[model samples]
Target: MKWSEVCIHTTNEAIEPISNILHESGASGLVIEDPLDLVKQHDNKFGEIYELDSSEYPEEGVYIKAYLPMNSFLSETVEQIKLTINSLKLYDIDIGNNHVSLSEIDEEEWATAWKKYYKPVKISKRITITPTWEDYSPVSSDEIIIELDPGMAFGTGTHPTTVLSVQALEQYLNKDDLVIDVGSGSGVLSIASVLLGAQEVHAYDLDDVAVESTRVNANLNKLGNQIIAKQNNLLDQVNLKANIIVSNILAEIIVQFVGDAWDNLEQNGLFITSGIILNKKQLVKDKLEQQGFKIIQVNEMEEWISIVAKKVL
Candidate 1:
């Protein structure tokens, strides 16, 4: 079988939204090549080694590559993807170069080539994300291991935004607490919440692909019973009071649902938001504050930011 490798030259800020666009268009097995990964020093406290090849990375902007089966509707699907991505500019998202190109490759090549880029990555104090194909063992008895099959999802669950969300969950989530994971891509945060002792989780995503991916991943970790994955827009009509609400979506989308988030969270419950660029930090912070949320912590990783807000009122 043949596969079309659709590569987009974009910015760090556009990663989440563009990836969503591709995933919604039926693209699978994404590969993100960022030059920043080469220069940035990763935290090796967990003794995980990161090996990156400079030749595969762009010298300037980030490169997002996804695999789509070459079929009769391939052209139409690609065009629709391009249109949807361009629409992101309406929301003030920086798309950077936005140069999209395509190449034909054999399925055999794509099946294994992208897997080399993913490894066992320790994102937080207790959470570690490893691909299903990799053999990894915990360095400590208390370590939390999350096995993800990237082929079935948009990411490997090690993106900075996801890392920050998982870290916040580690810090704020209580045992047996109910967690609401908005924009639950790959259901990584929801899985992490369960592994960290949450009794149950409600995972919601706007895209059906993401919803199914969440379910598949949840079951991959033997956590199917604890996570309820569904398709829903950001917190729309969600009335279940949660002990913790976490969203790792773009800041633009994050602000649109602040009121709903506040209404659904229990008093003194935590609202953890990531997928924010540096410039949009204040935008989300102000929106959360306007909704009566108290800003408790702000963390930065690379060009991304995560804000943890508490429902004080």
Candidate 2:
């Protein structure tokens, strides 16, 4: 089979949203090339090693690449992706150069090309995200490792949004607590919640590919028995009350379900949300507050933000 590699030049602030656009447009397995990664200092406290190649990254804006099958609808799909990216301007997002290019490659070449961009990284104080193919050992007894094969899914569990979500989970989740992970892409957070001692996790994603990916990753982490993976819209008709409800999705989407999240949680239950750009921080905060949730903490990493709220009513 043949594949077309689609590359987009954009800024760091647009990474999360643009990646979502590409994923929704049927591109699988994203490879982000940010020049900052080359010079960024990574702490060695977690016993992780980095061997970055500066030559592969652009000196200015970042490059996001994804693989799409060479099919009859490829042209239409690419056009729609470009249109959606342009629409991001209304959201006050800086898209930078916005240059897009495409190239053809064989399936074998496309399969291995994305691996070079992924490696084991310590995303938070206790969570380390490693690709399924990497060999990594925990340096601390309390360290938690999540092994993920993103495949055609939208998450690698290493994005800043995902990192913030997992970090919030580490701080707020309690032993034997029931967790509902909305937009459970790759099932990373659900798996992390269980590893952090949650009694059981319910993982939901609207995308069938993401639902299957979560199930596969949960099984890979040996937590399949603890995580129930299913395809469901965000919090729609979800009546089961949980000890905690966590969502790492767009701030807009987050707000849409804030009331539902509050209603679906037991009193004093926690709501953890991320995938919010800095610009949307206060908007989400206000929405959560309007829904009777008290903001417990707000976490920022790079251009992303995560809000931890509790049901106090």
Best model number under lDDT: 1
Worst 10 residues of 2 by lDDT: 40-49
How does residue 35 of candidate 2 score in lDDT? 83
Each candidate structure's TM-score, on Cα atoms with residue i matched to residue i, is 0.97, 0.93
151-205, model 1: which lDDT tens digit per residue?
8556676788887788889899999999999999889999999999999999999
Give each model's whole-structure lDDT. Answer: 0.90, 0.87
Model 2: per-residue lDDT, tens digit, 218-309?
Answer: 99999999999999999898898899999998888899999899889999999999989899999999999988999999988767899999
lDDT of candidate 2 at residue 211, scale 0 to 100: 89
Model 2 stretches with alpha carbons more than 4 Å out: 42-49
Winner by TM-score? 1
User: Which residue pairs collide in model 1, if any?
Assistant: none
